[model samples]
Target: MDAKVRNNTAHSRYELTVDDATAVAVYEIRDGAIAFTHTEVPRSLSGQGVGSALARGALDDARAAGKKVVPLCSFIAAYIERHPEYKDLT
Candidate 1:
């Protein structure tokens, strides 16, 4: 199933959903950009591309929001490096 990305204000987090209550990744927005700050996938959901999905979603969201990405998180930095399209916004 496709994942949906939702902002969870109460938690100050973004939720990546596989289904209701199934969050494979979570992130936070800091400064002017989206931060892939925290992430996780269920052991059952491992090796299924959930992390990449979350990264893409977060980056796309940042782009759409007209925000620059700082990529303080290692995974996010690596992802931005790999996807040069996002470098313009860094």
Candidate 2:
């Protein structure tokens, strides 16, 4: 769907919008780290790699900002687990 993830810092979440549906990866900043708390992809956007995109974008942003990652969200944790390149952020 060519969805691009964007960090909505004012709301503390990463968002991906497509076809009028928005997916979000919610997070909280604590102890100088980004802690992903929840992730939700609209059913319409499921099975389309939207979640992975959101997780990847969020993690990449954290890496670029030099912020440690605390992936409290199961989806995000599993994403990182599968992508070993991001292991150092944990």
On residues 16-44, what C-alpha lDDT tens digit does candidate 1 reach at each position? 76644444334466775655565666666
RMSD of each: 2.4, 0.8
* Runs off by more than 4 Å, candidate 1: 19-30
Instruction: State the lDDT of candidate 2 residue by residue for 10-78, as single tens digits.
Output: 999999998989999999999999999999999998999999998999999999999999999999999
TM-score of each: 0.75, 0.96
Q: What's the number of clashes in each of the models? A: 0, 0
Highest lDDT: give the candidate number: 2
Off by over 4 Å in 2: none
Compared with the true structure, the alpha-carbon lDDT of candidate 2 equals: 0.95
lDDT of 1: 0.68
Number of the predicted model whose TM-score against the real structure is largest: 2
